[model samples]
Target: MKIIFNRLYADYLMPSRLGEYEAILRQARDLGYAQLAVRDFYRSRDRSPPGRVLVHRHDIDSDLRTARKLFALESRHGVRATYYFRLCTLDIGFMREIEAAGSEASYHYEEVATFAKQWRIRTPDTLRARFPEIRQQFARNFDSIAERLGCPLATVASHGDFANRKLNVINHELLNDTALRQQCGIECEAYDDALLRHIDIYISDRKHPVYYRPASPFDALGRDRAILFLTHPVQWETNWIDNTRCNARRIIEELAWRTSASC
Candidate 1:
């Protein structure tokens, strides 16, 4: 019966609306989870507090408008979260607005894939040969984003490009290099295992549902365990149909932009 209900909720009830998210936040509070912006979690590492912790993270894949809405919703509940924006989607105004609303902002980078596509470097050999150049470009892009934000970005989340089969590089790999971390001044990765050490559970609304293989937040609540919830701003629509339509529109827009750029 519980499994049936979870499936139904995943299919019909989730990729929740703002109101649903608000209710979830309230429930987390009631369950004794303290909300922390990613930066706050790092700062409190030495003086660990009692009770569970919830680190809310948003990957702003597209649509700054919707991201702003999520930030406002979190603000209304007096909860803070981290927002990571892609270089192609950076909006200084929106970043500043969310920052003012008490959310932390950082980069969502896809430098390796971008470099691969730009150079048409498909093979592993080609990618290996151009590794240094790719790293240089990554640093430059990071600097550009940080300069625009007018502050150093402490954390970054890798943006995955599954469509790029030629360059199968994961963006987070850049952080694995100690020199790159020191040079870029990145204090943490959004999905770093080091950070996960403090978290007892992790949940996400990936692919438009509360993905449950191992477990979901619904399963972990009231267990006195720290949780990390990752969500994409594009998923939290009023309903599944609307979310699908919005995503379709974004794909069309992206295709049109690429076509126009090529011409």
Candidate 2:
């Protein structure tokens, strides 16, 4: 007996697989995009090269194995990317390996949301009341991750949690206070106005193509400008068949988590 995949499902599966991702990268390269890691983008402010540039960024939500595979592929193509990792998904070995492979590493933070939820903060006023605790927790987590990596983490990206509506706090808000930036010794948050000024477009593949709709500005890369491409490892697979299965499992798992959290 033979099993057939629906055309719509097959189309949805293309973007998240390894082959499609590689094709995208090759297209960008052919279009004269000089890929830069996040840290490099930060460094090249006034002296940015006169051409199109792609800032490749990866938020490693989970699944270290896939992340490593992506890293290897990028390495082979002579490309470097910045990877932001969550504290909950810390993998020192993989982190070191990726860093060794010429990728930059930074923390993917959601401390504000996590703190607000844990303390049952329901209003912005209440969130402000617990700012001290939140700041301290952020410092501790950052320090611990930095220490483990044996490197000074100069940048961070907020792990946006759209479901938590009560607190109205975002991780990037913690960097609003100059004192917080000084205290944590962090130079830049990925979403900061200063940093965003350099980026002409931002695209992300948070969920697979079918679920998460992204404004794919990269499709029209005719202008000589900076583009930030954010990707997650779990979304990409070796093939569409595997990608479809992975996306299905991820959707179910996310739904279950959200349902339990709501309860």
TM-score of every model?
A: 0.80, 0.80
Clashing pairs in 1: none
| lDDT digits (tens) for residues 1-263 of candidate 1 | 87766544643575546676777788888888888888778667558655788888888877566677888778878898999998766898888776777778888888776765565555656655677787888889889888888888888888887424434567676567889889989888877876878888777774434433346666676774788888876566534554456557658644643554321
Distance from true location, Cα of 215 in model 1, Å: 3.0
lDDT of 2 by residue, 1-263 (tens): 11234434443543447776787678778888888788878778668464888888999866666787788788878888999998867887777876787778889998887775565455677677777888889889999988998888888998876424444667777778888889878888888777789888887774433522345634645563788888887667434444566567657645654555331
RMSD of each: 5.6, 5.2
Compared to the true structure, candidate 1 yields what TM-score? Answer: 0.80
How many steric clashes between backbone atoms does each model show?
0, 0
lDDT of 1 at 16: 47
Pairs in steric clash, model 2: none
Off by over 4 Å in 1: 1-16, 163-167, 208-214, 238-263
